[model samples]
Target: MGIVSVSMPEDLLEEIDDIVETHDYSGRSELFREAGRKLVQEFREPSLEDRDLVAIVSALFPYDSPAVETKMTELRHTHASAVRSNSHSCICDDQGCVETFIIEGELATVSEFVRDVEATNEDVQVEYSLFPVDSIQRPTL
Candidate 1:
């Protein structure tokens, strides 16, 4: 086995230590190994079929980058059919911005929107979570 070095914020390290104790992990290495496996597995999963899905897409970038924001706006307009709603907020005294898009549509449409947002720019940090709409149980009338 090879050893790798990592650096993290003190607070994050503290949180990892807390988890180590709470979850009975042997150490940080063990916890990190498990987390790595989970992340890899998630990425390796096959894409879902074009089923109904709802997704919340978020993009974070510097507030001064109007180009990035403009690209996101264009993409939003291009995918307007899938976008249900959206919200934008400034963070860290306007140094950065976070834009959230609530989308509901076929899985392919939502996934395309997410891919477009992620490919906006290297500086833009994008994250999204999607859930199948059919998974929700509704009361029978």
Candidate 2:
């Protein structure tokens, strides 16, 4: 490992010293080493920020239509690499209906899939947005 120098405020340094002592670390070097390892692992692993995304799709489709289901299935298959989860709900009326889908995928793939699905279905009016994926902690119910 190469040696590097960084400046920290006195208060932060004191906090680091306290952590080092509490953890029984040999010194600040060991404490920083472990923290760096964890930081690297957190970024390297495919956390929500990397692979998690939510797409909320609002579309108009015929009542009791198979088109929506078919399109969703196609999207799932085509973008299987990015998908983590999905859910669908519908609100129907006489003229047409609005369907909503919550889909999780990589940002690019999910965006592309949404575009393709919208293009393929003429009768359906679709709008989609990506929800932020928080990786700092596990999602709570």
Candidate number achieving the greatest lDDT relative to the actual structure: 1
Q: Count the backbone clashes (under 3 Å) in each candidate.
A: 0, 0
What lDDT is reached at residue 46 by model 1?
A: 52
Q: Flag clash pairs in model 2.
A: none
Q: RMSD of each candidate?
A: 5.2, 17.3
lDDT by residue for model 2 over 1-141, one digit each (tens)? Answer: 899797766877999999999989999999888888985664344543456667776666766678666876787678676655555555544545565556666665566677776775656667776665654468689
Q: On a 0 to 1 TM-score scale, where does candidate 1 land against the true structure?
A: 0.65
What is the RMSD, in Å, between candidate 1 and the native fold over all Cα?
5.2
For model 1, residues 1-141, the per-residue Cα lDDT tens digits are 679798766877999999999999999999999998986665444554556788899999999898998997898899988888988899999999999999998766876787799888877888888787878899999
- Which one is best on TM-score? 1
* Candidate 2 local Cα displacement, residue 88, angstroms: 4.6
TM-score of each: 0.65, 0.45
